[model samples]
Target: MGKWLLPESLADILPAEARRIEELRRLLLDLYRTYGYELVMPPLVEYLDSLLSASGGDMDLHTFKLVDQMSGRSLGIRADMTPQVTRIDAHLLNRAGTTRLCYCGSVLHTLPRGLWATREPLQIGAELYGHAGPEADIEVLQLALESVRRAGVADYRIDLSHLDVVRALLETDPAAAARADEIFNLLREKDVPGLAALGPDLAPATTQALQVLPTLYGDLDVLEKARAVLPALPRISQALDMLAALAKALPGVDIGIDLADVRSFNYHTGVVFAVYCGGWPNAVVRGGRYDDVGRVFGRARPATGFSLDLRELAGLLAPATASSAVRAPWGLEPDLAQAVRALRAAGQIVVQILPGHEHDQQEFVCDRELVLRNGAWRVEPLASAEPAARPSPSTAI
Candidate 1:
């Protein structure tokens, strides 16, 4: 028989990294819980229709599809948690006004062969449903910032954008659908010349907006210039106004707006944002507003949320330091029973060496390993459970 192997872009987390990541996950979940966002575990897979309910744009292409034998219905591995959460808010929560929900889970996606994109990604995030004002957006943004801070990510920047602005400007013109798509693609790539080649069928006013598009990034000042040229575009103006408000609220935080950003999920009809830090191309956190996601599942509710890619965040993690080590008490063979009970009483992560697994002692993954040698007891350091310790395990009576 041929050897079995993991698929591309997928691999095991192993003990060392898995434990570390679990700690980070716990820290984030606790933070979310304290904010009154109850945690919910969405399924790893769902009916294809359920998964696709709120997802749009290139999302459909990235999802992994399969046929479920039990139900004989199409199923898809969840590509994102937002859609599933939206369904819950609509059909389950049934809140007339608002609901705050949190989730931590793994998501799967298909990607180009040889790409670094993990087929499996861990997501930790929260969703706020049924709020419509810019205040809701501000709340979501604040939570995102707090999540990063709790995770110890101090160096990062928030890149903000408004989907309604771009869409409103394009929909007002008479350009063909294909032409509009082409122009968007070009703008995404920052190809000003290709955008110009779309030919100036665009009205002079719209053309001027197009020209300024390349420079539509920076502080609140850009918002002023945009309004002067597209004064009648209320959708764009409203979104810019919200950005101005958000900037004022987020004092000392690095904030900027990108009007040309169109990569937001298909459901997002308002402000969209991504959080980035130096040395990484992937956004650690992504979120947006989806007012109609509830309507798709037979319930009408507004929703907004943001999720952080745990895998990407893990990539930027720094190694352990000496001050972070964990220690456990040593036990003698005569005191084995007492030591085990004492450790257990002290709320320590105690693992007794069950019979026949003596050889497995070398593989234990606790903060400290207790062994009964001769009449004395020994304590062994579990490097994975804590930071670096003496290379040797200790012995005592």
Candidate 2:
């Protein structure tokens, strides 16, 4: 392979794409701020113990580790920012009441999650700490929905599940982990024949319940059907109740319930949920209630949150039709230089032409041009292939 060739699943984000990501980042952080989620930026790398403290084995497998030259301790690049934020809540903030925290950054994964997945995911998320009630989970769910809405991505659905349901079933057969793994994989794959092949070793009732789980999806009626189909194990019953309540709370979103779905089950002790876009194979956002995540940090706070890949979300959203850019000739006069600086300060994307090179009209579609007009540097319209604005190009220019 060529030296410049990027590793598989790792690619560069060019300027046009990067602006969209940055715009979404700022918008989401502002949204989280409205909900009182103070921003915290954890480092990209940390000691292995801290990174892996609350995260489960799956995360460990994804994280990249290196020996720190100075400390000689194992350091790992974060594969997810949630655990790091949890540590912040438990150790640094140490607040007794509710703490709303949000973060946005890239996480390095050892492998791509899916065929088109990126190994370096630009993770943006919000975490609610010190609150374990269904209300907190509901609030986070609402936030997740709004995040996608704000990005202008439509036809998205949220699949809600409580791991406790599976835990309740699994508790019946602790020693049958091998059999349980087979069942879980079968359920994930939605392979009824595979599950049927392995059901004999499990209790007949458990087998029946597992069979119904793969089919337990769709609208609110799925929960109703689940009540009739699955056993009335206490924890499972409670989880179903919670899912029913969530369904009621989130009527606006196209919601589905997956009683058998257990993504991040070991890491998330309570409810686990994923948000999927229509026609997209993978869930764009995943989160759930993990109340015990902070315990290892010596302050077990109730925490629930969701994270979305910004790059993936940008892909889902409508392309940014209008971006900012103003062109100017090579600066010489003090007035021209001052005008360019002022334009930049005023938040206009100003591209000044260098002496040897002219501005690439295709790359930097200078919608507006800085020119000397009426003895003053003023913004003038440029004749372009596309109309920069409504009512045609300005006649004055």
Candidate 3:
């Protein structure tokens, strides 16, 4: 025995699950295509050096490393796809001014705690590189909203945050930079008590501003509350003003302004946001700008992108109806096999029971079964198939 082996946190997307995911991917691709985003696929693995060039802080820890046998250089399983997409724009596509791309695939990331994270995750998303204004941001946001709607999802909230706000506040106090790392983690985890304990008596106004962040999630009113406490920080004020403009443009969409929400990855340079539905512990879609990330690849093209875990999103949507499930036949006469395949090709589910295994019909759950009668193909419901009969004893035979 090979020890009944499998990696602890890894999993295979079985036929049924893969089909469901593919359906979702097709719908999203169609919606994106309608909006002018061409589809692209980057490599699953990349040279370690190129991969690390823009992997921002939190992302660096999740990448899986290995050594390439032929090249003798380090290689890594991509933990995220945005870095690779940026590489494509800077090196291959090299679109002179602007380019829009959408992609769907699996990414690998190792988690220290094997239980909470998977080594492989399916990702589907879009990226808009070269454009840096809020208009581009709005387009991507609208695409995300439309994609989810196309996927049959409703009732979700978007958490909007400004990376510039947090960076501005920290830059003011030189000492704050040293504690920047700790502050980043605290804000992401929403550890209000931890943030309070680190206090060396921050400016009264700064203190008030920080306090508003934890509860800043929800509608546009959060901006007003933040403005009252945000201190003399001009960058913070400008960021808030931009957010206010977005709020005005996107009325009726649930939006929240979280001043304390920090970017998990250093590559995110400006506005950052995430989309979450009720009952999901984590956000389904997340994206932000990274003006400096492109420079890592030796080009400074401004960029922003977001991706969803297709597998997780499928879980939220109802699984395909039983009748729609795909199943291959056990075996069939050559002609019958061709006919069954043709039916399947036309969107009808087909299953063929093998000779001598005809009694095994109960083992296969399908809406319709294909069989041969009078030298022709016949289709019948699962309930009509006869259950396999038990073998007769030698004496009876």
Best by lDDT: 2
lDDT tens digits by residue: candidate 3, 1-397: 3766678777777766777788898899888888788888989999988888886656667888999999999998888888888888777887788889988888988773223445677888898888878888888888887777777778788888888777887777666667778878878777888777766755544444555567776678888877776765899889988888766767788887776778664678888888887656778788877775767677778887788888777767876643322234565457756776677677655554455764453333554445455666655444532344222121100
Give per-model CA RMSD.
4.6, 2.5, 6.4
Summarize candidate 1's per-residue lDDT along 1-397 as a digit string, tens digits.
3466887788888665676678889988888888789898889899998888677545687799999999999999988888888888888878786789999998877873123657788888999988888778888899998988877788998988887776777778776233666766776777777767665666665666665677788766777877776646778778888888888888999987777776653567788898887667677888988788778799877778899877667766775332222234443454776766665676555566555553343333456666556765566666555343443446352
State the C-alpha lDDT per candidate: 0.74, 0.84, 0.73
Ranking by lDDT: 2, 1, 3
Error of 3 at 309 (Å): 0.7
Native-referenced Cα lDDT, model 2: 0.84
Those runs of model 1 whose alpha carbons end farther than 4 Å from true positions after fitting are: 1-4, 112-115, 176-180, 228-232, 321-335, 349-397
lDDT for 371 in candidate 2 is 75
Q: Which candidate is the best by TM-score?
A: 2
Cα-based TM-score, every candidate: 0.84, 0.92, 0.84
